[model samples]
Target: MNAIIENIDVLLSGFLTTLGLSALAGFTSFFGGLILAGFAISNNPTLRKISMLYVALMQNIPAAAHLFFMIFILPVLGLKAPFFVLAIIGVTIYFSAYYCQAVRSGVNAIGRGQLEASRALGLKNMQTMRLVVLPQGLRNSVPPLINTTIALIKVTAIAGVFGVTELFGTMLQLINVNDSAVIALMLVTGIGYSLITIPAALAAAAVERKVAFNS
Candidate 1:
């Protein structure tokens, strides 16, 4: 109790850092996924291939490897960034593949009839995708993407291992010196994470229900 009371400010700071990472990564990954989804469905064969290559590479790679490459390897190549920025970059890239798939799943749910109709109406491929496919695809994608975003928030805990001192990292730091309060520290960390995740999970469930109802 004393340890927690004494470290309230530190815990709050780390919580804020976690929030920042989650929010920034979520925002960037959303756009990244959208663009990749677009390319995957494009008329240009090269673009579709590029999209496939990118998604395969990102999806297959371990999340830690992505962060490790950014934080340690990139510096050797003369690319430098703050640890936080690197964390964001790594997380955003890894999750973009997931978002891409979500959006792609949405695109697949779209009827072939509408696609053929678009061409019958003289719309070019891009025009059809932009005007007809993506809007509906994106709408359908919301629930899964929300679920993915929840996962995204949880995965940011890995950032702590890479020296970002986020929520989990803060708990680790506190536990080292306050060894007797280890269980308390763990509970605090779990509660902190649950505060964000529980709500997102509930919201994801709600969105999922709404989407299913509408569909």
Candidate 2:
């Protein structure tokens, strides 16, 4: 018990580290995904084709391989980022691919007539997308985005394997240093994540329900 207390600061530090990385990556993925979805739905066939290939490449690649490539290949290009940064970049790229698809579906779900009406009212493509289509699409997209955020949180554990000292990394250290208490340490890590994530999930579900009723 005293050892657990002694390690409390380390655990808290690890939890915060994971939280920060998850939040940064989540934001990056959200915006990157939005841009990719826009490109996918653009009028130009060439742009759409490029976007399709981008999604296909990312979706087909295994995430572990992607991370390895990011860590190894990026350094070769003179970008020697820290492990946590690389982790965020890796997960952001992966999550953005899926997010783009989800948001694209939401964009498509909007009726063509509405777009035509906006154009008839002298709205440019940019104006129509910014002021009308995207707003509605975002409402439809949020629930899935929240779910993806939770999944990203879970996936950030993979950062530990790269020597990023997030929650799981610290847990790994603790388990290795004190093998007799592995189960307890794992439970501590699990509970730490649950404390942060459960509320976000519940709030997202509530918002989704509200959007459904309003829609």
lDDT (0 to 1) per candidate: 0.90, 0.85
In candidate 1, stretches whose alpha carbon ends up further than 4 angstroms from where it belongs are 117-127, 213-215
- Across 103-194, the per-residue lDDT of candidate 2 in tens digits comes to 88777677788788899999998999888888888777888778878888988888877788999999898878788777788888999999
**lDDT tens digits by residue: candidate 1, 1-215:** 99999999999999999999999999999889989988898878999999999999998998899999999999999999999999999998999999999989988988888889999999998899789888888777888898899889898998888889889888889999999999998899999999998998898788777666233
TM-score for every candidate vs. truth? 0.91, 0.88
Worst 10 contiguous positions by lDDT, candidate 2 = 206-215
Off by over 4 Å in 2: 1-3, 72-79, 116-127, 213-215
Model 1 root mean square deviation, Cα atoms:
1.9
Candidate 2 residue 122 Cα shift, in angstroms, is: 6.4
Clashes of each: 0, 0
Model 2, residue pairs in steric clash = none
